[model samples]
Target: MKLPALLRRRAEPAEVGGVARLDRRTKNLTKRLHPGEVAIIHHSDLDRVSAEALVASGAGVVVNAVRSVSGRYPNLGPSILLEAGIPLIDDVGEDVFTLVTEGDRLVVDGDRLLDTEGAVVVSGTLVTTDVLEEQLEQARAGLSDQIDAFTLNTMTYLREEKELLLEGVGVPEIRTKIDGRHVLIVVRGYNYRGDLDVLRPYISEYKPLLIGVDGGADALLEAGYKPNMIIGDMDSCSDAALQSGAELVVHAYRDGRAPGVERVESLGLSAVVFPVLGTSEDAAMLLADSYGARLLVAVGTHYSLVEFLDKGREGMASTFLTRLRVGSKLVDAKGVSRIYRSQVKGWHLALLVLSGVVALVTALAMTDVGGAVGDLLLARLRDLAYWIKELLT
Candidate 1:
């Protein structure tokens, strides 16, 4: 049965089912739930993170607001719920909350479980040992892919400026200043914004050295945070970010060529170029690690093959090397949107009009006898009545 339908037909608290309201970020709320507490998972944007957190928190039944109906494409949400041996009520929508009050009675027939009033009860089992292992494996695999994609995509942009990336600059490598300090590395992407939102409070509390990888400098600025250092090939980074007071480090190839450095200099930004064998993000991490930075937090970093393919990268060697270089100092911010805010861009209309004009001109030039053919067709249409009369006579 559909989740919405099932929720609508749920028995009263005194009859069979118990109710637990779950409308917040699972990452934060999951830790609050006791074992076997019914959880309603909301926040569609962070579906994967929410599912994982809820399952880890040991929720008995996870009723999701955003889910794949009819299993067309298997989502991480339903899979996590199933693996947890938790009954998944899909497509419950908003109305599911209206059916039950804070205290309700509920029972699961598949697992032979029951909950009465505000008390938690389990009959068969909340989650089986085997299912937990399977879920863990799946989650691990998914996380690996996500990281791999992020690494490869970051490399694509680096490779375009390979010559500059390998050249080493003469900046004094301070190896002890950042020791014991939390270092947050920001890379610009959809997930980066969200992760930053969540990390803002933590940043204020911890006061981590904020490092922006290329375009990620703009991300930090947009988040109202000043970056301490900007590292990358310099392409895709905003002009304002370049001008921001952060020290700039351009990733250059080993041959003493620094492409991105020139752009930074052109913007009148002081920078030191470092020739490295890997990606800019990799360079950022390595530089921090080499300099004795304590903890390295990565945001919006790619980690999958598909993501790499989308970025048009060739290999994963650099990412592997960088990860090895950073080791345990890395903490990935894969889903940090539980706290971030962002502005929406409204330039789509202007771009769409420009695209339409370019396409129209290209089509006109490509056709043979384009204008003459169009004129002939118009004349024929105008003489259609004369031809019709002649045919009738």
Candidate 2:
């Protein structure tokens, strides 16, 4: 058993070099991270998903302005980085973002931040698996507090978003007709790829209206299918998806302020603006339901309490209200895929019976018993023909 971060011996300075990429948003930072670059971020309570993205990017070192493992929960982000052999410096302070420019060469000697001129720019506390693991344990004790906060946030959200619960949706008209049809709404969430893989058969058969929610459009594109419609803040989506000729709908604030609309228009593309108070997935569902879709299948949608918490959602009032409105038509693809089985078609059973008759005839022709049966069948056929002729006469 390793000692807690407090009890563990302080680590000595070790040199590591890279060009710095600084961002307040870890998601935005991960997108631009090149191989072997040092990533500087301001993410507090770094989650598992963000950590995995950083590791995949091959970030040499992470300089954090906020706590990486703040004892809020047993977040696996910091531990994953450490296990992947990525050095992490925590609590460097917000001023670091202002001081450091993107692409500036920097050195992280343990927690000491050194500039190109060899001057100490800033210092931080080094993070270790031992320290983060202990922090996680303590964070588990704060679960009740987290739950309370979540509940309060949810209640507040419900008060603000009561319109969704009462009114179905004022879904705008689109060229893609969805009435009385199955609509598949895809999201980039946990097990999304796997769930989509399992639903491949359903997808091919039903050919549902494919709606991608922000980054979910990229997910659908990666899976080799074009989205019929794309909806979201359009922040996390790529230029490729935006230009893929899919009808784009920008999710705007209720006050009609759309941050992503400008980006779309600047690219010489047109998109419809939808102002609503809910997640992108919720928007997709409401749109599908409002368009009179016969069924709604959600891919990678977060529904469970723990899942919402893991996703860092303070409240799920929108999800709750959206589900309430579209619950009857909605189905989670993952759940359906687990119980789905291939149905035997009429032609399949017909082919099976035909094969059995052919096999029986072939066997009969090969033996004396078979020859006798064949003769009897020929005689019966002749008799039937004679009787039909007599009836006609």
Candidate 3:
């Protein structure tokens, strides 16, 4: 008789050992992750950002307490980890958290998680490329249902926040003047670093109002640009960024419970509380648009259906509607970076310098001083030729 589904054996496991780094929050855990450490996280449907961070942290193996891919949507995180040659042990159960402490020397042999004593602490499915692909396919099949949910949530928010969406009534006022200026709102999302690198020229030339959404404030700081205004729930942003003299806008719940305000106050900083029902990215857009920004440029903001679903937030629905509201003047920086070749190139600068030198020479040649300078330059060349010839001989 065939075995039941629960009784089925997992794929043959490979043995890999490292000191375990445990954190229920993947983002927080990533901060402490060192090279060759085992990352124990509880992130379900792991998003791209967290996955990329883990990969960058040089995590040797990832052990998830919950399902990495729940088949709700095709999230790109697990695929990234696999592609980075990082082994992933999936659905190891939350008991692993209680069973294993931080810095425990654990060995992941195929499906079994073992301790230094060779005792099986837990066992789970060793996720391979083929297994991940199958899960992705199933996840893709359910995307349509997710779209329906997204649309329904959008409609509900539209009905409740029509005044804020249509007229920008509830947006808090800030000291930074955005009138008739370009505004760059960064979110530290997909390809944010690359996007920011390409936008350096744009940022330099336009000098747009810089608005960092949560962790994006640190992104800007890392890129060597100071944000003029920092907006978000204040959870992920660093204390350094909050104290960087940027105007702080606390994105609060519609009921006026601004949790971020507490953090800001503890840091001896004041902030403008903008109470609204949406993600901070949405609020930033609405704030920029309402303030008469001539152009709104977004970096690392989720736009596609898969991206919205990958975020795993119902607030993404608000982001969708917010994009539509600001789509007229808003430009996704990723697309801009793809098409926006810097107008200034090396050859252009070289030709400009050559032209300036030529003009200076021509102008000097028109005077008696020019003839003397030319003769002196010719004598120096002749002397250099003579020295080279003497050395050769």
Candidate 4:
């Protein structure tokens, strides 16, 4: 069982060199990470979504200030980096952040990070597939504890927000007509770009009310669709997205304290405040449900248990309850894309036209009057051809 897996470990190079792009926030760091640049991040227990972002950024090497795995329920980020053929140096300590400056060309030689002066700045574990698998196995044994944490968090959330969850009391009124329309909620989660690409057909057909959650608003823009509404804590999305004329719904704390409100106001823009206990994704869903959306199609949102945990949030508990609240009205984009056959295609139209032409010809050939008309037409075609031949000669 282990032999093939061991053999599947990719051949790693001894050294890699690139310009260093340093940021503690992996999300912000990814935006600036150019191809062949070294990304310096302090992220621990790196989640799948963030890892996917790093991979997509085309970072040549990653140097982390903390353990990427950290025995946190087998987070897939480190493994994803290694599988993408990008070297990950794990746990070089917080001192690396102080030692390394932005745009400094650095070299990863085995386990050591070297600066432009060829001096070793930090030494950390070069994470390989073997290390990743072993750490993941150890992390798997602690999943029961994680589940217990989730349960506790869920109960706490339910106790605190029961009225909002059950009665729909605090959901804000929006001018956007969500009632009797399909609503598409987009989140910047795992395989978001791919999900958006696959959903293009559905998006084009139904023209769902697009609700972008934070960075997901920027995602919608990148996918060439303007969001009808942008919802989140307001940190991840770009300023351009905020100014795109989409209705902004800022997710705030239960105390009515909204950090996004300040940012939106700073931009000379207005937004509706949604004071909710759950995540922005949950807030978007609840808002749609409250406004009487017919069907909710979720794109790039976390669905599986592993995914919830991978987000590194105890607050995913609210998402669990939120799903239960939404019930049958909610649908995954992947599921919809799989089951919903495209209603029309170029080939289908072409086939329809060809069938009509064939039916017309068959009808024309099968009747006596049609046969006489066909003979006369053929004689006229022959006479026209002879005239064309004479002209050519």
State each model's CA lDDT, in order: 0.62, 0.82, 0.90, 0.90
Q: How does residue 26 of candidate 4 score in lDDT?
A: 98
Summarize candidate 2's per-residue lDDT along 274-344 as a digit string, tens digits: 87777778888888888789999999788765556666656455686678788789888755545655587
lDDT of 1 at 316: 40
Cα error, candidate 3, residue 225 (Å) = 0.1
lDDT of 4 by residue, 99-167 (tens): 989989999998899987889999999887777778888999898999899999999999998998999
Q: What RMSD does each model have against the real structure?
A: 21.1, 12.0, 5.9, 4.9
Model 3 misplaced regions, further than 4 Å: 1-13, 338-393
**Candidate 3, pairs of clashing residues:** 13-110, 14-110
lDDT by residue for model 1 (4-54), tens:
333333332222234574554454466476667677655442344456657
| lDDT-superior candidate, 1 or 2 | 2
* C-alpha TM-scores of all predictions: 0.44, 0.76, 0.85, 0.85
Q: What is the lDDT of candidate 4?
A: 0.90
Stretch of 10 with least lDDT, candidate 1: 67-76
Alpha-carbon RMSD, candidate 1:
21.1
Better of 2 and 4 by lDDT: 4
For candidate 3, the per-residue lDDT at 378 reads 94
Pairs with steric clashes in candidate 2:
364-370
Q: Model 3, range 1-393, lDDT digits (tens) per residue?
A: 222233233343468879999999888898889999999999999999899999999999999999999999989898788767788999999899899999899998887899999999999998876778788889888989898898899999999999999988988878999999999999989989889999987899999999999999999999999999999999988999999999999999999999999999999999999998999999999999999999999999998888888888987899888988997899988656566567898999999999999999998899999989998999999999999999999
